[model samples]
Target: MSLFTEAFMTALLVGAIAAGIPLLLAGLGEQLSEKAGVLNIGIEGMMLSGAYFGFLIAWKTDSALLGFLGGIGGGMIVAALMALLCVRLGLNQIVIGIALTLGAEGATALLHHVQFSQSYPRLSAPMVFSIPGLSQIPVLGTAFFSREPIVYLSLALVGVFAYLYRRTYWGIALQAAGDKPAALDSAGVNVMLIRSGAVLLTGGLVGLGGAFMAIVGAGIFVPFMTSGQGFIGIVLAMLARGQPIWVLGGAILFGACLSLTTALQVAGVDIPTDVIQMLPFAAVMLVLVFLGRKANLPSALGAAYVRGAR
Candidate 1:
C-alpha cells in the first residue's frame, strides 16, 4: 500500500480542518474580548469547562446539539465570573484569569475521575453533511465539502464577525470600549455592558470550540485536553490585528502544520513523537516572530476601565 495515496492525503486535509476549527473559534472569541478591552487569559478554562460539560451532556443524552449548548453554558459560566471580577469590580485581569484556569483544571479533573475513571467511554461518530456538487470534486470534495455542520457554521462565523466589525454600530462601540472607555462612557454608552457582553460572547464561542474538540475532533473528553490551544488562539487573534479573515488564515496554517506532522508520522519518519508534536507550535511562533512586530493590538487592552477615573 502506497503511503501517499489519495485517501491518505484526503484524510490529512480533513484532519487539518478538524484541528483548525477549535483554534478559529477560540481566536475569534479572543478577538471580541480584546476589542472590548479584556485580555482573556482564562480562555483555556472556558474551553476545558466546555469540553467537560459538552461531552458529559452528549454522552448522557446522546445528542450532539444539546452537548454543544451545554458546552456554551459551561464556558459562559466562567466568563460571567470573569466579567464580574475583572470588568465590573476591577480586579487584576491576569491574576483572575490564571486562577480561573487553575480552578477549572482541578474541578474538571476531579469530575472526570469521579465519573469516568473506571469506565471511559466515547461517543458515536458525528453526522457529516456533504454538499451536493461540491462533495463530488476530487480530493478537495471530501476534504472541504463533506464535514459536520458545525464546521460550516464555524467557517461562516468568519464572515459574520467581519461584517460585525466593519458595518455595524456595535462594532464602533466595541472599538470605543477597548480604545477609550471614558470617551464611550461620556457618550452615554454603557462601557461595562459592552465589555461584559463581549466577554460572555467570547465564552460562548470558545465553549463551542471546546465542544467541537470533544464531540467532533476527538470524540471524547480528557482533563486538560485543551493543552494550550486557547493560548495559541490568543496568538492568532493578536497577530490577526483585528481582522477575522487573518484569524482564519492563521488557524488554517496551524491546522495544516498539525496535519503535516501526522502525515510525517504515518509515513514512518524516524523522529521522536514529542518533536513531531512541536511542529505546529514552532510554525505558529515562526509566523509570530516574523509578523508580530507589525501586529496592531488595541491600545487599551488589559487595562481596567473605571467610570470616571482620569
Candidate 2:
C-alpha cells in the first residue's frame, strides 16, 4: 500500500492542531502585552519555565490539571520579576527580557538534571474530550471536534477576545494603555498597573501553552523543550496585527503548514533535514512578511513608562 492515505492526512492534521495550540496561546498573550505597550521578549522564558514546572508537578502528582496550574504559576513567577524590573523600576525591556530567557533556560536545565537525569519520567496518555454529535463526522470529527478540552477552550477564546476587544471597557483600556499611556494616565487609569496585569496574564497563557506541550504534546520534559514555539508565537502576534481572530487563523495555518512539511519529509521528499525543518518557519515568515507590512504595532511598545516624565 502507498504511504499516502486518508488516515495519514488525518494524523498530520491532528498533529498540526496539537502544535498550533502553543503558538496560539502565546501569540494571544503577546498581543495582549503589546496592546498595553510592553514588548515581551521574555515569553520564551515564561514558556520554558511553565514546561519544566508543569512537567515536574505532573510527574509527581499524576494530574495534568495541576500540572497546568503549576505551569501558570511558574510563568507568573517570571512575569513578576519582569514587572518589578521593567514596569516598577523602569529598566530596559530588551536587556531584561534576554536575561530572563537565559536565566530560565539555565535554571530549568539544572532542575531537570537534578531531578530526572537518572530515571527519566513520562506521563501516561491523556484523557481527551470529544464532542458528541460533531465528533461522529468522519475526518472532521477527529480533527476538529474530538480533541483535548484545552483545544476547544483555546478556539473559543478567540471569540471571547473578540467580544472583549469590541465591547468592553477593559479592552479599550488595554488599547489605550498601549497606544497612549500618557493619555491613559491622564484619564485616571493606572498605566503601570495595566501593563503589569498584561504581562502577568501573558505569562499565565504562555505558561499554559508550555504545560500543554509537556503534558500532552510531548509527554516528556527536556532542556529547552519549548524549542522556539514562544518566538514563533511572537511572530504570529505581530502578524495578527492586534486581531485575536487573525492570531487564531495564523496559528492554525502555521501548524497545518508545519504538518504538511513533516508529511513531505516522511514521504521521502528529497529535501535536506535542516531545510525540511525550516519549512514551517519559512512558510510562516514569507506569508506574514507580505501581509503584515501594513501591520501597525503600538508606538509606545518596548518603552518603560514613567509617570510625569518629559
Candidate 3:
C-alpha cells in the first residue's frame, strides 16, 4: 500500500480501537450483570459519576492510577445501592435502576461543583509507550503495541472474561441463576450474592471506561462526559445475546459507526455534525424495534428470584 493509504488505515484503526474500548468495557460488565438476572439502567449515570470522581481524585493526588481506582470505587458504590434497592427490598428492577441513575447524576453534578468551584484541572496521564520489539511492525503495531497500558488492560480483560464465562464453574452458576434460579436456590446457591457481584462488576468496568475518557481521551471532566456510551452498552449487551464474544463484535460495529461520524467531519463532508451524530441512536432504535420481539431474554430475567417459592 502507498504511504498515504497506510497512514489513513492506521488512523482509522486507532479511532475504532479507541471507540471500542469504552463499549467493550461497559458491555462486558453489563453482560455479567444481566446474566445473573439483574438489569442495571444506571450504567449511564454510573459512567458519568466515575468520570467526575476519578478526574477530581487524580487531579488532587496527581496520580492517574489513583484516579482510575477512584472511578471504579465510585461506580461500585452506586451499584451497591442499586443492589440494595432491587435485591434487598425486592423493588422493581427497572424503576430502581432509573432512580439510581437520576440520583447518581445529581450527586455527580454536586460533587463537580464542590471540587472545581467553577473550573477543574484536566485529569492527565503519562505518555503511552510502545512495547519493546513488538511496536515496530506495520499497521498492527500502531493499532495495538503502541497504545496506552489501559488499552492493553482492557483487551486482556476481554479475553479473561470470555474464558471465565465460557469455561469456569462460576460462569455456569451465573447462567443457572438467570435461567433457573429456583433450581439453583434449591441446590444451596446464594442467588442474592450472585446478583450483587454481577452489579458490582458492571459498575466497576463502566467506571473504568469513564476514567479512560477523562484521563486519556479528553484529559478533562465535563458534565455528561460519558455521553451515551453506557446506554449504548446496554443495547449492545442485548444485541450480543449475553455472549462475550458477540459483545466484542457488536462493540466494534458501534465503534465503526462512531469512527465514521468523526471521519466524515474531518474529511469535510457537507452534512451537519448533528446529523452524523444521530446515526448511532437511529440505528439503535431501528435495531431494537426490529429485534425486540424476537429476542429471547433469559427465562428469569426481570423477575426477582424468590427462594422456596414456586
Candidate 4:
C-alpha cells in the first residue's frame, strides 16, 4: 500500500475506535436494561442531556473527570424520568422514550444557549492508559491500548455485562425478570428494583458516552452534538438483541462507517460530506432490514412488568 493509503487506513482505524466507544458504551447499558425487559428509547435524550451537562461541568470546573461524571449523572436523571414513566406510571414505553428524547433535546438546546452560550470549549480530557507491555504491540496495540481510558471502560463493560447476563446469578435473575417478571416476583427478586437499577445503570453509561463525545471526541459542545449517535446505539441494541458481544460487533461496523466518512472528509475526498454523514443512518436502516424477524427481542420488551401478570 502507498504510504498515503497506509496512513489513511491507520487514521480510519483510529477514528473508528474513537467513534465506536460511544455506541459501545450506550449499547452495553441498553443491553442490560433490555435484558431486564425494559426498552429505553430515551437513550438519545439522556445522551444529549449528558452532553450538555458534561460540557458545562467540565468547562466550569476545569476538570474533565468532573465533567464526565456530570454526564453520567445527567443520563441517570433522564433515566429516572424514564423509570417514572415506564416503571412507575405504567405508560407506553415507546411514547415515554420518544417524548423524553424531545424533552431532552429542547432542554439541552436551551441550556446550551442560555448557560454556556453555545460555545463550551473542550476541557483537557483524560489520557488513555495502556496495559503495560500490551501497549507495545503492533496494530493490535493501537487498536486496544492507545485508546482513552473510557475506551477500555466501554470494552470492559461489554465483558462485564456478558458475564453478568450469561454466567452470574444476578445475570440470570435479571434475564428471568425480563423474560417473566412474575417468575422473578414469585422468586422474591423484587422485579421492580432490578429493572429500575438496570435503567439507572443504562442512563449512567449512556451519559458517559455523551461526556466522551464532548470532552474527548468533539472537544466542544455544539447543538445536537450527539448527532443521533444515541439513536444509532438504540438500533445497535436492537440488532444485538441485548447480547453484549453482538452489540460490540455491530458497534464496530457502525463505527467503521462513521470513521470512513470522517477520514474521507479529512482526506479531501470528492464525496459530498452530506452523503458521508448519512452513512451511519443508512447502515442502521440496512441492518434493521437485514435482521428482520430474526432479531429475537425480549418477550416483555416495551411492556411494564407487573407482578402476577400471566
Candidate 5:
C-alpha cells in the first residue's frame, strides 16, 4: 500500500481532529479561568475525573450525551473544591492545584483497579454527523465536515468564546476580575462570584474534553490517561493571550504533530518509540520557547482576591 494513499491520509487527518478536540476544549476552559484571575492548576484533575466518570456512565447507560454530562459533573465537583479552597479561602493556588491533581490521579487509579481490573472493556464507535453536500468533497470533506457532533460543538465554542470575550458585559467583568479585582469589587461587581463561576465553567469544559478522550478518542478509560494534556492546554491558553482563535490554531498544530507521529510509526520509521511519542510535546515546547516571551498575562492572575486589601 502506498504510504500517502487517499485512505491513509484521510485516517491521519481524522486522527488529528480527534486528538485536537480535547486540547481545544482544555485550552478554551483554561482561558476562561485565567481571564477571571484564577490560575486553575487543578484542571488536570478535573479532566481525569471527567474521563473516569464519563466512561463509566457511557459504558453503563450506553448514552454518549449522558456520559458527556457525567463528565462535566465530575470535573465540576473538583472545580468546586478548588474554588472553595483557593478562591474562597485565599489559599495557595498552585499548592491546592497540585494537591487536587495528585488526589485525583490516585483516586481514579484505585477506582479503575477495583472495578475494571478484571476485564478491560471498550466503548462502541460514537455516532457521527456528516454534512450532506460537504461530506462528499473528497478526503478533506470527510476529515473536516464529517465528524462526531461534539467535534462541531467544540469548534463552534471557539467562535462563541471569542464573541463573549470581545463583545459582552460578562467578558469585561471577567477581565476586570483578573486584571483588577479591587476595582471590580468597588464597582459593585462581585469579583469572587466572577472568578468562582469561571473556575466552575472551566471544569465543565475541560471535563467534556476528558470525556471526549475516553468515549471517542480512546474508547476506554485508563489511569493517568490525560498525560499532561491539561498542562499543554495551559501553555496554549497563555500563549494565546486571551485569544480563542489562537487557542484553536495551537490545538490543531499540536494535533497534527500527534498524527504525524502515528503516520511515521505506521510507515515503519526506524526511530525509538519514546522519540516518536515526544513529537507533539516537543513541537509545543519549541513554539513556547519562541513565542512565550510575547505573551501578555493578566496582572492579578493566580492571586486570591481579598476585599480592600491592596
Candidate 6:
C-alpha cells in the first residue's frame, strides 16, 4: 500500500483537526482571560467538567446541541468559582485556580465512578458537512472541505474574535481592564464586571472545546481525559500573544505535529516513546518562541484590580 494513499492521508488530516480544535477553543478562551488580567489555571478542570457533562447529556438526550449546552454550563460553573474568589473578592488567582482544578478532578472522578464505570458508552458519528464544490476536489477536500460542522465553527471563531478585538466596545473594555484598570474605572467602566464577563466567556468557550472532544474527538468521557490539553492551551495563548489568528495557526501546527508523531510510530521509526510524544509540545514551543517573540502582553496581566488604591 502506498503511504500517500487518499485514505491514509485523509486520516492524518482528520486526526490533526480533531486534535487541534480543542486546543484552539481553549487557547482562544485563555487569551481572552489573560486580556482581562486573570490567569485562569482552573481551565483544565473546566475542560474535564465539560467533557463529562457533555458526554452524559449527549448520551441521555441523543442531541449534540444539548451536549454542547451541558458542556457550556459545566464550564461556567467553574468559572463562577474563579470569578467569586479572584475577580470579586481579590484573592490569589493562582492559588484559587489550582484549588479549582483539583476540586474538579476529584469531583469528576468520583462522579464517573458512580455513574459510568459499569457501562462505558460511546456515541455514533456526528454530522459531517461537506462544502458542495470544494468537497469534490482531491486531497484538500477531505482534509478541510469535508468535516463536522464544529470544525468550521471553530475556524470561524478565529475570525469572529479577531473582529471583536479590533472593532468592539467590549473588547476595548477587556483590554483596558487588563492594561489600565484604574483608567477604565476613571472612565466609569466597571473593571470587575468586565473581568468577570471575560472569565465567564472563557469558561463557555473552553467548555465547548471539551464537548467537542467527548462527542466528536473521542466519543466517550473518561476521567482525566483532558490530559493536560488545558495547560497546553495556556502555552499556546501566551505564544500567540493577543492574536486569535495566531492561536488558530498555533493550534493547527500543534495538531499537525501530533499527527506526525503518530505517523512516525506507524512507520516503525525507532524512537523512544517519551521523546516521540514530546514532539508536539516541543515543536510548537520552539516554533512559536521564534515566531512570536514580539508579543507585547498587557501591563497588568496577572494583577488584581483594587479600586482607588495608588
Alpha carbon deviation, residue 234, candidate 1 (Å): 0.8
| Residue pairs of candidate 3 with colliding backbone atoms | none
Reference-based TM-score of each model: 0.95, 0.94, 0.90, 0.91, 0.95, 0.94
Assess each prediction's global lDDT (C-alpha) against the native: 0.91, 0.87, 0.80, 0.83, 0.90, 0.88
Error of 5 at 16 (Å): 0.9
Task: Return the clash pairs for model 6, or none.
Answer: none
Q: What TM-score does candidate 5 reach?
A: 0.95
Q: Which residue runs does candidate 3 get wrong by more than 4 Å?
A: 1-4, 265-270, 281-293
Per-residue lDDT tens digits for candidate 6, residues 10-103, read 6667768889999999999999999999988989988988888898898899988899889989988999999989998989999998899899
Residue lDDT tens for model 1, 49-118: 9999999999999999899999999899999999999999999899999999899989999999999998
- Distance (Å) between predicted and true CA of 45, model 1? 0.2
What TM-score quantifies how close candidate 6 is to the native fold?
A: 0.94
* Models sorted by TM-score, best on top: 1, 5, 2, 6, 4, 3
Cα lDDT of candidate 1 equals 0.91
Which tens-of-lDDT digit does each residue in 1-310 have in candidate 4?
3434645666777888888888888888787888888988899998988888888888889888888899999999999999887987778999999999999988888877886675555566567677888877765677778777778777888888888788888988888878888888888888888888889989999998998888888878887888888888887887787678988988888787878866775566767767776787787787668765676777887889765555
- Candidate 5, clashing residue pairs? none
- Residues 24-123 of candidate 3: C-alpha lDDT, one tens digit per residue: 8889888888888887788887787777777877788998888889888878888888878887666898898888778877887787778775776765
Worst 10 contiguous positions by lDDT, candidate 3: 1-10
- For model 5, the stretches where C-alpha displacement exceeds 4 angstroms are 1-4, 265-270, 288-292
Tens-digit lDDT track of model 2 for 199-303: 999999999889989998999999999988888889889888899999988888778766766666555555555765677778767776876476799989998
